[model samples]
Target chain A: MTKRQEHILQIVKDHGPITGEQIAERLHLTRATLRPDLSILTMSGYLDARPRVGYFYAGKQAGTVISERLHKMLVNDYKAVPIVVQENASVYDAIVTLFLEDVGTLYVVNQKGYLAGVVSRKDLLRASLGNKGLEGIPVSIIMTRMPNIVTCAPEESLFMAAKKLIDFQIDSLPVVRPAEEDSRQSELIGRVTKTTIARAFVELGSEPFL
Target chain B: MTKRQEHILQIVKDHGPITGEQIAERLHLTRATLRPDLSILTMSGYLDARPRVGYFYAGKQAGTVISERLHKMLVNDYKAVPIVVQENASVYDAIVTLFLEDVGTLYVVNQKGYLAGVVSRKDLLRASLGNKGLEGIPVSIIMTRMPNIVTCAPEESLFMAAKKLIDFQIDSLPVVRPAEEDSRQSELIGRVTKTTIARAFVELGSEPFL
Candidate 1:
């Protein structure tokens, strides 16, 4: 801002609800000279003006800013490293890997190292309920197979990933990129889970940002 | 915005890199009179000004806005109804309730209807791994007991609840209120889960808000 504008803002902030003529008097300028400044200030959300009340410092609106930042947050920057198991791995081994890695969902990869399926804790627990022992059963049999899995791209917005999680009523989404050898195959790179959204929400509310 | 201010904004947006003098001439206004408006517009992030070149519209910075809206969100507004089980209910019953309700966590309540413990999918999965049959064991034996469970108040900001979820590494928090008979006892009223955070994130990125 120019020195004069800064001086004008200070005056308004300190002695606000003050009239334009009064402000011009202090600055030794005509009200006409201050007209455009006052107009711009009010229009841009820096100050508020009223008929009888004159002008008052109208601070930034608290509920007015959210989507702009959310759109800029991409999945690549926030996705966590995916925990995966071989499609042939037993449900028992998949459960152990889930415990060892401390993740809610496990991506299943085929022998070709492309995404084959996804197994969540709910899926594992449901499988355990069966009379058949978990060790003998392959995760691929119980997992949500390829075409049914909800996946996201690294370039997608984190907001979109979060939306998919909510819409699908699932806990996580694999961040995948098309395989170089075959565009039809998906190679898992990372994951975006509800925990990721929660972490991002916490960061958005943290000190420097607040 | 005043009609004049809107007109000024449109001029800058359409004919940016046009000099202040050129703008003034087109609007049939004196350059000196337009100075304050230009200053205010630049300072408020509506326009970018270059020394020799002139002025250009500077669109809202996408990465600049987030925390304000997050702070406005309250747990009371976003919390989901708590899915709960009796403390003495068998672990097997709790698992059934979890699947029936499609929730990852369940609050365990005492006979008096006060919060006694909390159980998560992880907890149930671990219990299922034990040699002891889930049907024979009470959820109280496997749940995270009282005083150890992280909880939130209905009045707290959703952001704080989300922060607790991340900091404590928990899946969900029981939104509690003091029991009518005893202030020390917590009465479960609602829940805030990572799913809740994910849902809120999606809403923040939805249309109209954007």
Candidate 2:
């Protein structure tokens, strides 16, 4: 909208049901001059008019505004600190960390501090079954290794991260960046999970509806 | 908007940047008589107007329309069929069911088919650790018992269900209905999990933006 259009909108918003002639009077313009502006404003859904009652502000739709805001939300803004375990860590140790952190998934980093694998509760549970010596078994044996892991980048939209979680049917995503030493190796920076998506959904729902 | 207003909007949408005199002529009405309707249309964001260039349709914002539709989505519409296990089922048996159904959580029901408890992969994992005789222990022994379980109703908004998932820090919710035999007992009808919310989020994001 032009400066004059915005001004006209503000006037109608503040003192709406005011006629085109009255609006023109405030703007120091003729009613004929304001005709196009009024017509444009009404057409764009910024105002409402009634026969003999004049123009009034039509409130901005919350959905459009909120949707735009939502689309701009990035994974970097919402990702949680990732929980990591060494690839050599025992299945027992991974399970302990899982309970202590109360997280559904764990990232397995190799000796170089680059992501090597991802372990979920399901993996640990399946490994634990009928196993008397969980401590002896290396977590790497059960972890979903790199190349098979679904990951997200910090700059990606949270929506995209959420989509990854759904599409991959995984509980969490390692928010990663390329390792300084090896481009093929990922440095786990953070995490996006189903919980993150759920939290975002709640926040969206809780925003004051216009 | 009135029928005449809709008609005017359609006309402007189809042949916009057309003058008010032209629109009035098309409708068989004088320009003066159509002034209020045109003003209303412009103010309400249905059309845009430019001085000398004439009026044109201002497209509807997708966000608001999608948001309204999203808010109307109920759990009943998106809930998935629940996977359940009997209360007396062995923890070993529950583990088999969890893997077989490929579900993160399982609802436990009594012989009468009332919701008895909720079990999750975490719960099963915790029980499996350091235990060799998994079949000896009943799942009910480790399950999060009723009255402590957080649940959702079929009529609840998916947003509300998502809220509960985040707020309570749970993996899934048993979508329940009151049992016919006993009003106090809940009958498992469906399930809502983080996956469900993520799927919904993906769908919302996938919608074509206007």
**Highest DockQ against the true fold, candidate:** 1
Give the alpha carbon lDDT tens digit for every residue of A25-129 in model 1. Answer: 999999999998888776665565656546655543323446656777899999999999999999999999999999999999999999999999999998887
Off by over 4 Å in 2: A1-67, B1-69
Q: Residue by residue across A1-210, what tens digits does model 2's lDDT show? A: 789998998997677657899999999999999999889988766776766657766555434544555678899999999999999999999999999999989999999989999998888888888888889999999999989988999999998898788877788999999988889989889999989988888777665431
Which whole-number lDDT from 0 to 100 does residue B91 have in model 1?
93
**DockQ scores for all predicted structures:** 0.29, 0.21
Model 1 Cα lDDT, one tens digit per residue, B1-210: 456656787896676656899989989999998888888777765666666656655543322345545777899999999999998999999999999999999999999999999998999998887445778999999898989988999999998999999999999999999998899999889999999999988888774332
Model 2, residue A166: what's the lDDT? 81
> TM-score for the first chain of model 1?
0.73
TM-scores for chain A over all candidates: 0.73, 0.72
How many steric overlaps are in each model, in order? Answer: 0, 22
The runs of at least 3 residues in candidate 1 whose Cα sits more than 4 Å from the true structure, single-residue gaps closed, are A1-64, A130-132, A207-210, B1-65, B130-132, B207-210
